[model samples]
Target chain A: MINEKDTRLSKAFITVSFIALFLGATAGLLQTLVRGGVIELPAGIGYYQLLTAHGVLLALIFTTYFIMGFLYAGISKTLGTLYEVPLKTGWLGFWMMTFGTGLATVFILLNKATVLYTFYAPLQASPWFYIALVHVIVGSWMCAFSMWRQYYIWKQITKKKLSPLFSFMAVMTMAMWFIATLGVAAAVIFQFIPWSFGWVEKIDILISRTLFWYFGHPLVYFWLLPAYMCWYVVIPKIIGGKIFSDALARLSFVLFLLFSIPVGFHHQLLEPGISHSWKFFQVVLTFMVIIPSLMTAFSMFAVFETTGRRKGAKGLLGWLKVLPWSDVRFFAPMVGMLIFIPAGAGGIINASHQLNQVVHNTLWVTGHFHLTVASSVTLTFFGISYWLIPYLSGRTLTKKMHKLGIIQTVMWAVGMFLMSGAMHLVGLFGAPRRTAYTTYSDHPQAAEWIPYQAVMAVGGTILFLAILLVLYIAYYLAFRAPKGETEFPIGEVEAAAVQTPIILENWKLWVGISAMLILIAYTLPFWHMIEHAPPGSQGYKFW
Target chain B: MPQLETNKPKKLKKAEKEQDLKGTLLSVMLLGLFIILSWGAVYALYLSR
Candidate 1:
């Protein structure tokens, strides 16, 4: 069990996260409706404004807060209670992040920062928005340091060579976050803040974009690794299986840390100013990151097969039938794992330089991430919430709540299928994303996209309903569920699993390699961009 | 010669523990095929465009 004091901190973070979910989902609902021509917004609230809120609140605030809370709980549970210093640090981080979120959110709501989540250069928001981002990143850094300190203390006390699997994964996630955020931190502090504040008259658009994406690409992994932690560490226990291999899991995570950061140029493959060679290089590294995902897939299937066979199941696929489909804890992440097949496929296509031409800046790209982060990652987060909330709150997930959770998951899957499916199809037909409802003066091709938009509207409405259900369930679990113990399900490794090599625990080696890769991948291209730098442009407030 | 003797039983033990999961093999193969097919489809589109 997690300590009572630590639970308070986790509960606070989760509470704020759910609040963001409600607000963000509401913004998402409005966006779909507006884009579908089902409704027109009043002049006071613009589509871009709602879009900004949707991205920031859900993609940034909800994920970060939820991840921090979940990591804290797992760390406290596995590494023992947080010491006074780290505990206080956790609280300090929580307040700062909350304050930053509040400040950034207020600016977005006022439409002063309608630059969308990427907040791409040449478009500027209030200086406060950038400062708010700084707070959020630094605040997360505080939590990351605290978790590391806790792990270090555990190692010192126990003198154990290997950290607990969950804590190890947490440190990996936070370490990657610290390294990845440096790019965005540099961009925001040096370029964005000063430019927006008029301390600088102009900004180097290419450098700013290069830096943002340096953070942006790995930012997705930061969101994804926690979900992976659940898949690798927690799901097997829920399914009555042992981890297929501790060494394999740690090795895959190590690979992710090394490969995920240096591949940022895959996002910039189409953007000019960066040479084709560098983009191609990053694309190759992006493919290298796929190795770990493939490893994860193999490991997952092996775990299921081994467990089912041990249960006396027979036949090639008999193991699938033995899985606990009725349990929401398993069902939610099970569906997520299934969705990731296509999501991972789509990611490969997106990073492919030539194939990216077919979908870049299109609704297909939007549809792709919706499948990945929204469906796969978000569903896994919800699965974690089902147990983590009740466990932290000292309550039980009653049968009724379980039923509701399943219904919510189904609703989400169906909604996503309609919305994201239509997006992918229509985007192939050249429908642009991030635009308000328009027939382009009734052009014939533009008219073809109408049906898909309508379908997306229907999907969005269902998704909004699902969001409401999730919120209600969160409330019920936190306050009304019967007082009882809920197992914080963490799986054990199989006895026959190979011993995790001590090299996997070597942080300096991994981080150093990661940094070296980033430098090699970026150094010359960055120097070129600076040397041949075009004159900077003053910020625009097109909104 | 000494190293080979020491590693011999270890290799056998490793092989013994490694189960040939036919279903997992087929599943991942199918996953790989899907990725290839999707990439090919998009590539064809890129070519056409």
Candidate 2:
């Protein structure tokens, strides 16, 4: 059924990944230009609708594509077998998702459902919009299944234990993905479809957001883990060092799994409908999250230390000098590390139960997420593409492209630093997020923030250009390649041999997941408390 | 497989990190102290203010 003439599954995934980044950049730039009033399209012509398209296309879809592409590319190197699942099935999935994205984009453009990314309950979009969303999530499920089937085949061939660190993390993340998307899927099918079509009287806002955040919170790590996976695996290889502590990375994944879901209650902390004690409990547990986060930081920095020693660099800060600066893969992760600082600071600030009052739903919260989610994670994905695409395609990414990638990476990092930081300041000064427009009446001088908006627009423009370059390079390597089999090291740093996870399949872990669900369900309650702040960003919408 | 490497027993006892994040070690101790102090400050200033 197969020939050497058949197209590489990696090629299809890379193509999708290319398009995803391109669309993501295009949508991102469009939103930024709109925000700055630099390029005005007619106001109230379904602007919220455009925002929804941008959110789903760039944030969720792009991330999904890149991670799936990266996974498909590494099949043999990761599995230690030449075995592969049917690339045709994956191609089938590719078209299904691609077409779904097109349908959803059209609906968004028509302003059929401008529910914003959160798409809070009671505020409904059209039935088409809900259906389009179902198609997209379902398409992602198909992609996940395709990867799992490949893993199954690889295991069948190897029969070795499934303990390769990167592979384990990939499957763990997929495992997380299948579980995490349930909340969003549940909301779409049960609440959104019926509610949007006028089938249900009205769905509850608070409870829906709770379930949404159940998916949403873990979804951050879902966006994030692949990037971290690249960090753990790729960075060490690029720098010529083994992983500093492989077990710590594993522990971090497990801890992330445990914490990311239960901590959604922290998001509901200020909501009055939730019990005081439960909110307090989540706040405490929320702080526990930084353990794995910091553990990762330490683990990787230790790798850098090891790499630096290999490079003959000296002193506590010596690694700074010898790290492959021009190699976009190496420096992008380094820059991503720097971006994490204030982002982490913002996260800790927001996760604080009492402190959240000052910044909740404000520009500050948006600022924090953009830094962590958009900058740190997205940059790392781009960084991975920079390293992997050429290797997978058996083409050499030239010095100039890598050089240009460094410039683009810096642009993104610096741009985010300026943009997210400025947004935080604006948020503290009472600027609300998610509004299509802002009006100043009582405080005429509220116009001072215009400069910051302008600065953000400039930053976003630079990053947009950077994203375009990344896509172009990715396109060339995947499609235009005059190629042979390229041997890519899927970073053989895990000295520990592969062990198939008996623990992964355990009934106890399943119970822990259920208990996690139960714990989150018990904690999610902020919908009814409209006395202090309006349910749907009420306090900040101006007169 | 993990047991193969971890045979060189952990010098730091589990008791240190075993509790709900309390007591001893450079990173953990400092991080814990930072957490407790920050929580105390937030409750006092922002919540009670």
Top lDDT: which candidate number? 1
lDDT of 1 by residue, A1-543 (tens): 778999999999999999999999999999999888899998799999999999999999999999999999999989999999899999999999999999999999888999999999899999999999999999999999899999999999999999999999999999999999999999999999999999999999999999998999999999899999999999999989999899999999999999999998889888889989889989999999999999999999998888888887789899999988888998888888899999999999999976788898889988989999999999999999999999999999999988999999999999999999999999888899888899999999999999999999999999999999999999999999999999999899998787999999999999999999999999999999999999999999999
Question: What C-alpha root-mean-square deviation, in Å, does candidate 2 show against the real structure?
Answer: 6.3
iRMSD, per candidate, in listed order:
0.9, 8.0
lDDT of 1 by residue, B1-49 (tens): 7777687977765764565488899899999999999989989888887
Candidate 1 regions off by >4 Å? B1-20
Screening candidate 1 with a backbone cut-off below 3 angstroms (N, C-alpha, C), the clashing residue pairs are: none
- Number of backbone clashes in candidate 1: 0
RMSD of each: 3.0, 6.3
- Tell me, per candidate, how large a share of the native contacts it keeps: 0.89, 0.05
Query: How would the docking of model 2 be graded?
Result: incorrect
Once superposed on the true structure, which residue ranges of model 2 sit more than 4 Å away at CA?
A1-7, A37-39, A43-45, A80-89, A479-487, A494-543, B1-49
True-contact fraction in model 1 equals: 0.89
Taking the tens digit of each residue's C-alpha lDDT, what string does model 2 give over A1-543? 112312265556667666766766676777667776577766665446666767777777777777777776655466543234446556666777777777777777777667777777666666787787777778777767776776777667777554577777776777677777877899889877876676656566666777787788778888888878888877888877777556667767777666666667777777656677777777777777777888876666666665665577765566667778877778887788667756776678788776888778877787888888788887887777775776666666667767877887887877787778778878776677775554466466567766767776787887787777767667766666556444354555535324334565342585477466545545334433333334332111111
- Interface DockQ of each model: 0.67, 0.09
**Where does the lowest 10-residue lDDT sum fall in candidate 1 chain A?**
A353-362
